[model samples]
Target: MDFWQWYVRRGRIDRRTWWLQYALPIGVLSVLALMADVALGNSSLESIATGETGYGPIVTLVGLLALPASVSSGATRLHDRGMSAWWLLIGLVPLFGQITLLVLTGFLRGDGGPNRYGPPPSAAPTAGPYLQPEPAPEPDRPPYWG
Candidate 1:
């Protein structure tokens, strides 16, 4: 599915997808557990590296926590726009670059209303933010009086 499609389906950015999508990265880190065997064999990278390095694990855990769904959805968005998922690094550009990238991704203009992705979102008339509110009705009078 396209980005907008994914976005609408998911409704909101979430953590479950992050874990699934980033399974590879987390698997790589799990290799760290092997350090114990290496240490026992006197062939470890660091014999005394203990007390939970803290940052690396914390960061990895957080990334894994958010990888599965979010990353997949983000990729869909890029594909919908004929852009590369790597372009998501635009988040690292600092200041306006990040904001611009966010705006583009957050809003799905769709592919000409119906591109290779699929049909527009049901083609229903969407309410715009600028729509004027309906005026309040006055106190009711008898129908016969009117």
Candidate 2:
């Protein structure tokens, strides 16, 4: 899938894909922020913790860009589990809510088939009707079996 569809689209996303989408950008951005901190002559975590502002703007900008995409992907992941997008608000409820959302989105399997959100993420797109083949004819059988 395209990056936009994978990260920004409001549709279903299975757990495996959700985990990757959720973790990758956060991990990459954290590493980049650490590198920027080091290049600026600050002790990475200590600088951030001490309220140093050197790398803050860079980190803030990257975080602003990533936040919406992260929320969108998370909402879609919730949809895959047959839950409403509103479930994302649970993260605002403090530590317990955040932990609950993590467990629900990261560990639970999605609904078994097509759901209100859409088909399973792994399903192939359907071709036009003209591309479909006719059903095979039935074979002749003995009268007793019939």
Candidate 3:
């Protein structure tokens, strides 16, 4: 699937694919969080801590990288439900939005087994119609590398 299409499509990703999709951004964020904690310590009060320089720029950069992936993840989740990605805005309604997003994230609808997004859940094991078929195996020769 293309990146955006993969991002959409109903249902929680199987563990393997989920790790591939989220691991990098999450790992980077974790590293950044670790660095922030090391630099700033875990002080609850902001006023008493020694201010660290140069972290602002780094934190901003990491946030920019992470935010798009996060948005993509959320949008894809909505797409999985056959809903438009814009529905992610439901997360903007204060506590209501939080509850809505929680319900949406916890939902497990599986694209009704496949609609415009791609093949049905049962068909996922086979190539979806959009895929190009592999060349037939040759009896007299090794398979084509191209």
The top-ranked prediction according to lDDT is 2
- The window of 10 residues in a row where model 3 has the poorest summed lDDT is 41-50
lDDT value, residue 3 of candidate 2: 70
* lDDT per residue as tens, model 3, 1-146: 67765434454343234346664556668577646755764432243245543344445566666666666666655556666778878888999997887576444554656655555434555656678787689899988777
lDDT (tens digit, per residue) of candidate 1 on 68-95? 5456666555555556668777777888
lDDT of each: 0.50, 0.78, 0.59
Q: How many residue pairs clash in each candidate?
A: 10, 0, 4
Best by TM-score: 2
Clashes of 3: 4
Which residue pairs in candidate 2 collide? none
- In model 1, where do residues sit more than 4 Å from their true spots? 1-60, 121-146
User: 2 or 3: which has the higher lDDT?
Assistant: 2
Against the correct fold, how does model 2 do in TM-score?
A: 0.72
Ranking by TM-score: 2, 3, 1
